[model samples]
Target chain A: MEKTIIVNAKSKTYNIEIIDHGLKKLREKVQTVWSPRKVAVITDENVGPLYANQVQRQLNAGGFVVEVLTVPAGESSKSWMNLEKIIQQLAEKHFGRQDGILALGGGVVGDLAGLAASIYLRGIALIQLPTSLLAQVDSSVGGKTAIDLAAGKNLVGTFYQPDLVLIDPTVLLTLKSRCLVEGYGEIVKCAALVGGDFWQLTGQIKSPQAIMRNANALIEASVRFKAQIVAADETETRRRQLLNLGHTLGHAVEQAAGGRLFHGEAVAIGLYQLSRLFEQKKLTAVGVTEQISTRLQAVGLPLSDDELGTTDFYRALKHDKKIKQQQLTMIYLKKIGQPEFYCYPIKQVIGWLQQELSQKKS
Target chain B: MEKTIIVNAKSKTYNIEIIDHGLKKLREKVQTVWSPRKVAVITDENVGPLYANQVQRQLNAGGFVVEVLTVPAGESSKSWMNLEKIIQQLAEKHFGRQDGILALGGGVVGDLAGLAASIYLRGIALIQLPTSLLAQVDSSVGGKTAIDLAAGKNLVGTFYQPDLVLIDPTVLLTLKSRCLVEGYGEIVKCAALVGGDFWQLTGQIKSPQAIMRNANALIEASVRFKAQIVAADETETRRRQLLNLGHTLGHAVEQAAGGRLFHGEAVAIGLYQLSRLFEQKKLTAVGVTEQISTRLQAVGLPLSDDELGTTDFYRALKHDKKIKQQQLTMIYLKKIGQPEFYCYPIKQVIGWLQQELSQKKS
Candidate 1:
């Protein structure tokens, strides 16, 4: 099924083909979609060492001056210094009017590279080749490219639409265990949102090997779930807020952990918390919290909030960019394949956190 | 006079209106153009001290929350660190999607504030109230906003277009002598490029006071000339390149002087150098260079390359952003109101620079 996510807000927005083996029509893709002379492919050390040459060769073969710029892998590299260097290089290389860039790595590379593509020459044609599971499933399609500042993650960035996204399902085979589990958290979020079809498919993905090895089923199910959410609200204005089911607390968990917690592991804990809160509100039935915890743990994710040290959890939550109008908007899982967004006023949310702290002390 | 400057490559663009007593329509002018909740007016110490309060009052009277964000006046503030701080402040202040920003200072404020507007809440509405003469004519109109880095100026920035440009001619009344002359360089460049009825006006204006004293004549002439050139070619692919007449060497002059050389002064010298070169090419004969040089000199401008030290001339020229295919393209003057772009091969341009240097040494 080819469903296109139309970001109708911008002047130039193209269709996003949500299907497996999307990278097969590489040359035709470029000709049909973009009209760029030069393409700077920014990747990470890990992905660059593996697939940089192949991607570069393909782009070069498709008639582009493909320049491979690689940085070391990790969340830390998404810095101002790195962004400035890439901008200078882009200008020095004369990546101008007809020229653009291809972001070829996981989330950090996709983010920083996309940001570079966004600002350089003021919005160039961008193509995403997301190597990591995290990027391919979530970050790549969202049109959100940002670099982190010292204060927190993604403090400095912009929302720039990419010309095309190239997802090679074959690349997921190289992901580590931690990466695989984190990727599945988003996959599970998809399952939880899209209903019986996605939930049944995710339940069938019991074995870690089955989930990791299976590309076609994963891509189809995951892309469909994501395509629906993105199609409805591309800018995250209304209905799109529900897609952040576990991310509110999960993002804070990652921050508190100081980049220690893999995004999926943190999300699992967020799902657990959200489910419990939903149960308290009668939005979810009894045992939903346990189901979420069990499912997440089975998928090799930590479902407990024990990892988030009590002291910095509240501090981290304050910096959450998603909070607008002094409300700590939380998305909760009402049931499997069901999510709901409810604005918990900041005072109440902070009070709940304090209650949790008191219970721990007692 | 009613011509529109179509920003060739980009999606969004608005008109550059240069009218007398623009302050009267300040409310209607901004509201009609951009209906933002909050206008994040980034001013500097100098401009803010003078006009920030008045602008704030005007916007407030129009029922808008005008937050005045002030930074120290200079080029040094245009940095990633400052950008980070501004983003943090905007986020912390709860500047939402409905909110936009008003850039109320000169180039530095416009660049920094416009860049902020481009990124904040994934880009919001931007309005320019450029105070400096350089900013009033140039930066306010073009959507090219950037911050400088150690490597170069405007190294990391975006082409974020503004919704409206509020060029209050009254602001020019308070401008220092040196800065006012700097603005004239842009006017002269605009005059030289679109030489027809307005072309004849350039040679006639004997004093800087001619521009400073009269609002209607100066605004009408400057706006028409620039707007036409911009209308012909917005993104500087061909026709717009003529606007950069003296900038090739002018930017180097500013960098060498450590921000001492006002932008207009550099252009004045750059124009002189270019006019002399045109004379050598038999492009502009009959004492065109002398005529233009004397007027600019009378208005307190450095009109000759002979005065500027020879050191770092080659190095500065190399770093120019307009270089293409290893050639240094220059926008030269053929007459008082006409500019011609010559994509001189780098070797020849360097040869010319050495000749100029030797001539100056003698």
Candidate 2:
């Protein structure tokens, strides 16, 4: 069965199609949304070797000229040098206003390509071919595209929505077991934010394999939940900040871990640590932390990082883009499925992290 | 005397305030539209020496903490290196979402600063303090912020509208004579598009000094004309292409000149040359070329480039972002004020240019 979730952003509205093997119908699916003479398939070394040739042949069969532009696969590919390279290639190839880009890898390729699409000739048609579970459920559904600066991850980016997003659960089969598990961090985060049937569904899935078996349902739920939140707040002025539940500390932890942790792993740890601290402070309902930890651990997500108390972690936390006027808006759960935001001083946030670290060590 | 032109773009609606010594009221005017705790006045070496401190002091007096960031004063400043530096500086300084950037120089500074402001923290408050006549009348009023690339000019950009635009004609007093005359290229282009009173006023003005004498009225007319067109077509899908009356060939001429011709000077030559060719082909009225030539020369603008027939000009023209699928859209005058768009094959455009060059030689 195929499910289509319509993301109604302020700038544009597009559909996220989730199916068993949507890649087989790539040309037909893309043609329905946007028509371009040429399409640049921007992928990374990892996903490109696996899927780029197939995507090119499919689109070529559909009468679209396809060019596969590959970058080194990893977080490092999302840099200014790669961004400039991609844009310069597009221009040198004479990709016009009517041309399009297909981001056909994980979050890094999606972000770098999406940012390129947004600025090349002031934006062109973009279709997301999210090949990973995390990208399908979180990054691909929203229109946030960015390249990292030395200061922080996603410190520089634009909110340019894609024309269409095609998610195929079968592609997730190719993702390594660790990569697959990392995606569940965001899945659990979404489930926690939208607690009804989704949370129950997440709780029932005991392992990564079981979650993959029910991937379609879980992906649809997460996409729908995010679509609703993004539609209401496209620019993250208020409600959109809810989406950053685990990201505040998650980014800091990720930065501190330096390449040892994937994005979702850090987010998983951030989710657990923040909730535990909130419970201790009497802000979150008692036992909510236990429930979150159980769901996360059931999916094999790490609940804490040993290096969480490092100075690099604190520095990354302070450099978060969410900090406005020395104040940070931290998202906490009053209860499962009920998230609330509170403003704290930077010093206070660091103090809470320190307190959490001491308590965990004790 | 002060005149305010309200621009209603799809992304934002802001006022373009034109007055004598408007820099004196910078803080008061900025407070009306946006509130930022800290303001970064991004200026150029040339303009910084003249007005940065005064603007900083004024904003400081209004309880806004002001920081001045300066770059070299030229088109080269609109480079990836400068863009990266500006963005990194903003991140290092911890500029938040509520913080603002005041672009307080000519088109180069405005373009670079505006691009920085748009991508920093995914966007922040921006106020365009356009000092040059060209910027005040054209680039600053529109939400088109960009940095040039090695492949082409404005290949990377975003349509991010400023919260407000402050244009003080008194700043023109400090502009070099060549710079002041260069601004008249865009001013004439605008008058030619809108026709009627704007065109008549443009014709009545005899020289660069006369333009300065009537700067308020001329600037108001040009800004109002552009504001309406931009409001109608913010993304340049259809009607907004009319604004590029001379820009298609103008950009090519400018690129080929290799910094010898200011943007407006190349545009003036483009305006005259394209009109002459259109007249010879009977696509434009017989007197249209004469009228364009007279106005351009009246303002001491150049109407011809000696390097018009060079391969560099042809290459630049072929690389224009406006070229869509080997087809180019050329804007021409139907009469003094009326403009029309005609799509020609890239080959046909080259042929026309070649024929024009041959005829000039004869």
Candidate 3:
């Protein structure tokens, strides 16, 4: 389904387009809107060296300065120090006012660099070019850009919107198998939540390798699912918060692991734990956990991970950014294709984690 | 002329009232919108010992947790290391999202604490209680919050808007004579660029000592003038940039001077130099230079100070955050009250500065 959602914000109406080859008309569409004099492309070292030259050439041909800024790959680059360095480099290169920043990497780059553009002299133009499946479907579609602190992941960020999102399916062919499988977890969540023909395709995803090898169809479906959600709730005021389904524990696990695990990998383990808990509490159907587990297994993500956290898992939960008023709020799958956030108070989570971790010792 | 302009932002609107007793109504108006549970009042050694008790008592009686967070007063306190300490303090105090941070000192506190608030779990809330006249008129109104880096001043910052501004004119009476006079320089620039009655009022300032003793009327005038400019152009798009009249040279001078000279003092000299440059170039009236000198003299700001950074002035210009495209864009006053920015090619300013410094040495 190629659905379009229009977001109206402060004399600007940006369209969230979800379809294969969405990058085709982007040059024409953006040329009419943005000033093409100076476009600073921010990507990670992994992605930058791969696609920087091609993107720069195209943008330069379009009459843009097209300065390529490469940060080291992974989450560690999204820090105040990195932001300072980027700002200094941008200022040196004269990227300001009329200029725009093209975020051309994964979630970390998009979030941090997008935030940098947002507050650069109080909001510069942002053009998102997501190269990963996770970024294409989730990170790139939404305008929530920021960096992490020692306190937690994405604890410091902004609700900054990008001018346009450029997602090329061609970019997915170059991704790692683990990255593809991790992205597929979100695809499964989205299909289950949105629950339309999108679910049918995801439910029929029998082999993870097969879907990863031919991801154009999966990419299109997943992008539409995310686009519709973000378009309705651009600021994450109400509806968008639900999309954080497995993210609460997932983010904490990732943060605690200190970048050892991928976001999607953590989320898969988090989803499994939450599903089992939901079934135990009678919050979910008897067969729901099995159905989700089967789908996740097909996508090459395990139903259980013994090496997730330590005896201090409960302590790590305290560091989650979603936490407020000592209540552990988490997004859980209500059914195979439905999700919602339920507030599991901190005291109860600590008690549950203590019991679960203690059981391991026995 | 007393004018009240509505600050138009998506969040909320507040009146920028150019009148005495603006502080009294300000509290009531802000309370009507977003009432703070507690007012964590962060002040400096000088400003805190004086007005912190009074403000605390008022807010306490008004039913808000009025804890005072005081620090040593100066630009050195604006550093990242100092900001980290303040953040630690804020965390230990367990200042929740419902509570707001109030900057009761000058620009240093406003910038440092405001940056802390901006990034403390991705922004809480901000209230400006600017004591120094410079902060009261400039940083207080705008959302340009930041902390200084070891590299340069205001190297790390965000454009975070304050929920309320509480400006008590009575507090101005207690300000140091030199400090008060330095602030008057900003008002002089405001008057010169804004023109009309503001310009005429500039002539009325007899001495820095007198200005300090009686600055309520002038403070309101200065604040209201700039407030109107910012209200229309909140993020410094077009007209708001006009407020930076003489800031190019002023910022360089201030940065070079480090903490020895206050912002307003450098601005005073910058304004004087700008006026003189215009007069010399046959761009203005014969007595324009004399008028600027007289106004600054009356305000008790040392326009041609021997203590200023005559040595490291050019070096400071290299760090101007606003510098883009290798051009040093400066805001200069055309007439007594209308200021304009002239983006000079960097080489021109560098050559001229070198020649001027050599002449000064001779």
Candidate 4:
């Protein structure tokens, strides 16, 4: 079965296609929007070994010249050094404005390559082929591309939308059990924000395996919800802040953990912790925290890290790009499916986190 | 007296203010659009020593915490190395989305700082304070931000418009005579493309001194013409390509000259040579080449470089970003003001240049 969700962005409108084995139809789908003389398939070490050859062969069969560029599969690959490397390589290969870049890995490759495509010759065609669940449902669909700076993650980037997005759920069967569960972090977060039918569907799915069993439906729901939000607020001026639901604290937790947890794991913990704090303050609906904790724990996703302390989180927050004029805009729940933006003074936010930490220790 | 021309870009509508000694009103102009807590004034070594302190004081008086970031003065400063340095400094300074970047230099600083502002935190407010004639009349008004790569000039960039543009004609008095004359390359090119009254005004101005004497009128006409072209075609899809009147061969000539020639100087030669060739082929109107040559020579601009060779020009043309699918888009004139696009096979373009070079030698 094939499901297509059209995203209307400020610059262009494109489609996100979800299929059982969409990789097989990659060339045909790409040909609809772009017909480049050459295509650079940017993947990472882990994904390159598994699918790069297959993708290259598929594109070649369609009479397209294809070259695969691989970076080491990790968040570290999303750096200025790698970005320059990719751009220089493309320039050396004589990639023109008519050429295209196919980002064929998870979030790291997607972001690094998307950013390269946006600035190379002032932008060329970019098509996203998201293999990981986190990417398929979230990162790949949105046009937000970035490379991390030493100070923080996504500190340098552009909001460059892709020409098309092709998501193949069949690839999930190749992922490790842990990687599959990590994808649920965003799934669960979206479910919480959307509430209603999406929340009920996600809440009922007890394990990663069951979630994978219904990947098509869940992926479509998440992408559709995100697409609508992005269409209305492409630049994230106001309503898009809601999409950063767990990301504010999630980024802090991820930074504090220092490679110990995946981004989705950090986000899972952020969603749970923030809800608990907001619930205690009567800002969030009663039972929302328990509901999120139950859904996350059921899927074996971590809710907290005993190793991270409040000081580490505070340090990370200090460098966050979201903080403006000594205030941070945080997203909280008015109820399941209903999110609100609240501006908090930096000192007050730190105080709240510190008080919550002390109580946990006691 | 201040003359304001508003540019309506796809992302923003900004005012380009032209006034004598406009530096005195820098803070007042900036305050009209942005109220940032901090503003980073990016300039080059040459421009920094002259106007950086003055700009900082102006912005500071408006309660904006201002810091000056200066790069070396030259075309070489527009490189990946400097781009990284500027971005890293902005990140280190904890510059957020609300912060603004005030580019206080010529083309190099404007391009570099504009690119930095476009991607830093996915974009921040950018104010262009173009101090050079090439910048004030051309680069600054159009919002074509770029930095050079090892492979080519402006190989990596973004089409990011600025929040405001301030042009101070008083700065021209401080420029070297050679530097001041170089600015006419683009001014003359715009006149040829927009022939009617603009061409008449530019044609009558016979020297660098005369052009500067009528700087306000000439700059306003050039900016107004460019602003309309950009507003209609922001991304250089079709109509925008006409603006590259002499740029195709101009870039090759500039690259072959290897820093011996200023960008405008190469463009001046490009305007003369291409028109001569096109006029010979009857593609351009009769006497068009002589008209361009007369205007360029009257302003003390070079019509050709004796040092450059056909092979050197061909080598550079091979790397131009405008060439797509082994074809180059060359702009020609139907008459004085009427420009048209003609795509020629790369081989044909090389053949034409080779023929022209041999004739010159003979």
What's the lDDT for all of these models? 0.73, 0.90, 0.72, 0.89
For model 3, residues B70-179, the per-residue Cα lDDT tens digits are: 87888878765666666666655655555678788888899888887777656777777787888877777767776665555665676677776766666677777777
Q: Which residue segments of model 4 deviate by more than 4 Å?
A: none
Write one digit per residue (lDDT tens) for candidate 1, span B325-347. Answer: 56777876656555656787877
Interface RMSD of each: 3.4, 1.2, 3.9, 1.0
Kindly indicate the candidate among 3 and 4 with the higher DockQ: 4
| Residue-level lDDT for A74 in candidate 1 | 93
The Cα error of candidate 1 at residue B199, in Å, is 3.3
Model 2 regions more than 4 Å off: none
Give the per-residue lDDT digits (tens) of candidate 4, residues A291-344.
Answer: 999999998999888644567888997777778899999899999999999899
Rank all candidate structures by their lDDT, best first, as comma-separated numbers. Answer: 2, 4, 1, 3
lDDT of 2 by residue, B1-362 (tens): 88888999988888999879999998899889766588889999999999988998889888888889999989999998999998888888878888999999999999889988888878889999999999999999889989998878888899999989999999999888899999999999999989999999988888889989999998999999999999998999999999899888889989998999999999998899889888988989999889889888887889888778789999999888888889999899988888999999999889978887978877
TM-score, prediction 3:
0.84
lDDT of 1 at B5: 34
DockQ for all candidate structures vs. native: 0.28, 0.80, 0.26, 0.87
Q: What is the TM-score of chain A alone in each candidate?
A: 0.91, 0.98, 0.91, 0.98
Best by TM-score: 4
lDDT of 1 by residue, A174-281 (tens): 788778778888877767777686667776666567776665566666765665666666667788787788888788887888877887777777777767766876
Residue pairs with clashing backbones, model 1: A192-A337, B40-B101, B182-B264, B191-B337, B192-B337, B192-B338
**Which candidate tops lDDT?**
2
DockQ-based CAPRI category assigned to the predicted complex of candidate 4 = high
| Predicted structure 1, TM vs. truth | 0.80
Comparing 3 and 4 on TM-score, the stronger one: 4
